[model samples]
Target: MCSHYEPVITKKQLATHFKVADLEDGLKPELWPGYIGPFIRKHEYADVGDDAVPFRELMVGSFGMIPHWSKDTKIARMTYNARSETVAEKPSFRDAWRLNRHCIIPAQAIFEPDWSTGKAVPTRIVRTDGKPMGIAGIWTGWKNPANGEILRSFSMLTVNADDHEFMRNFHKPQDEKRMVVILQEEDYDGWLSATWQDSRQYLKQFPAELMQTQTEAWTTDLP
Candidate 1:
């Protein structure tokens, strides 16, 4: 599962990449489960027909998902990643999946542990061609009962990567290998518009040849 990532771009750049309007805020270079980050989704616009250009909106959303039925935000920590194989059947993600609430989590690169070394080392993985990735995700909104304020959050979907040449290197040797579903540029709209039944087709692993990894020595040092 993807737990750490970096978005090395300005709000304007992010908005431009998604062909959305300018955003007023930017995300931290590094983001964790509770941190807020940018996500793109279609928005309904008045006087716009379905055949017209789709209205896309780039907004900041909490990284972890807080289910609507949850009494508190504690669940967000464990809900950061939803497995693609059973997302539609999992209690935490089924509702959103059934409702087709999809979003795109864009990032410049992601961090994973490289276990080839004697000790686990933090390594950054990015596209060999230096393009950003748009990871597939599902989102939901929960209302803060006290203030009646809505908190939106999302979770990245992951698929088994044990057979993947590059992805199988991460995580502990005893643990099951998994990787986030990184959608291709041509499939972005299809993923976002897919029905629950069609969503499964987009959960396949990304090409390993287009990916590259780097380990920063300082990142593995003890605090």
Candidate 2:
């Protein structure tokens, strides 16, 4: 799973990809740790907005999952990604997963470390079709008890990539292989409103055939 990723900063995520309306709080070009980014969840009747929106609603959230019990926002640094196998049991991620607070993190690409050269080399992994990837995730809103300021946050869900052909090529040679769960475009609605049980079906790997890679390293300073 990637800790640093390029979010869907353009309108395609809502206008064509996810098909939502507003992109509140805007979005960041890159998300690392607590950086703000847009995530889409199933719209609820109680949500404040025009009643004419589609099934999904886009929102702004910190890249890391912030738990209700957290005293501050620092916890986000470690909760940026959740392991699918134990998501339902980890204290910080259990609640969101159990409640099925599912969301899709639209990303232009995700950066993974390629260690084949005996050193970590940053590599960008994107869909071969050049469309934004709708990554399966869980979200929650943490209210700052000091001032009652509520901040939404999310964590990308990931799976074991030991058997994955493309994903297994990234990361360390001795470390466990892992990759984020990328949902097919047609499954966007299904994943957004999925129950905890049904959610498991989408926590799988995206086919390598549909992906391409960038071997050149990039820097946030210039991006």
Candidate 3:
């Protein structure tokens, strides 16, 4: 499961890479469970006749899922990563999953702890081609009692990575290896428009060869 991740993707990257134009305010550069971040969801302009309307809209939301039934946003801390196997049954994630509230999280890279050397070391993971990743997730809206403000939040879907050649190397040797669901560029549109029955098909792990990891020595960002 992810503790936290840096979604270093900028507004320009969101436009060109994800083809997103309808956007909300920007979020922090890095995101913890309760921090704000950007996510892409399929939206219809309420018109099927407009061929030029953008199908994808970028919006700001908390990294962790804040279920509608929850009393507070505190639930976000523990609901950031939804397990793939039980996502449909989990109380916090089931609503979004069943309603097809799928979304795409644009991330330039993700940080995972490498515990291979008897000590934890922060490591960076990125696509081999140096492109931003479109991570799969589900979103929901919660009404705050204190201010009556409705805020959107989401959770990243994760799958068992124990057998994955690259991802399996992270985390503790004794712990279960898991990774975020990374969707292919070609499947971006299809994924956001997926129904509950077809959503599970997109939770597979990304190919290991197409991804590479770097220890805590990286300097320059991807161009």
Local distance difference test scores for all models: 0.82, 0.89, 0.87
Better of 2 and 3 by lDDT: 2
**What TM-score does candidate 2 get on C-alpha atoms?**
0.93
Count of clashing residue pairs in every prediction: 0, 0, 0
Give the winner by lDDT: 1 or 2: 2
lDDT of 2 by residue, 37-116 (tens): 99989987524676675678788889999999999999999999999999999999999998889999999999998898
Relative to the true structure, candidate 3 reaches a TM of 0.92
Ranking, TM-score, top scorer first: 2, 3, 1
Candidate 3 shows a clash count of 0
Give the higher-TM-score candidate: 1 or 2. Answer: 2
Q: What TM-score would each prediction reach against the true structure?
A: 0.91, 0.93, 0.92
List clashing residue pairs in candidate 1.
Answer: none
Q: Which ten residues in a row are the worst by lDDT in model 3? A: 214-223
RMSD of 2: 2.4
**Model 3 per-residue lDDT tens digits across residues 14-58:** 888998865555566667789888899987471476778778878
lDDT of 1 at 205: 98
Residues 1-223, model 1: lDDT tens digits: 9888875357565765666655555557777787777777766461277656656667677788888998877777788899998998888899999998888888889988878776777789998887888899999988888898988889999999999999999999988999999999888888877888888899999998978896554332221
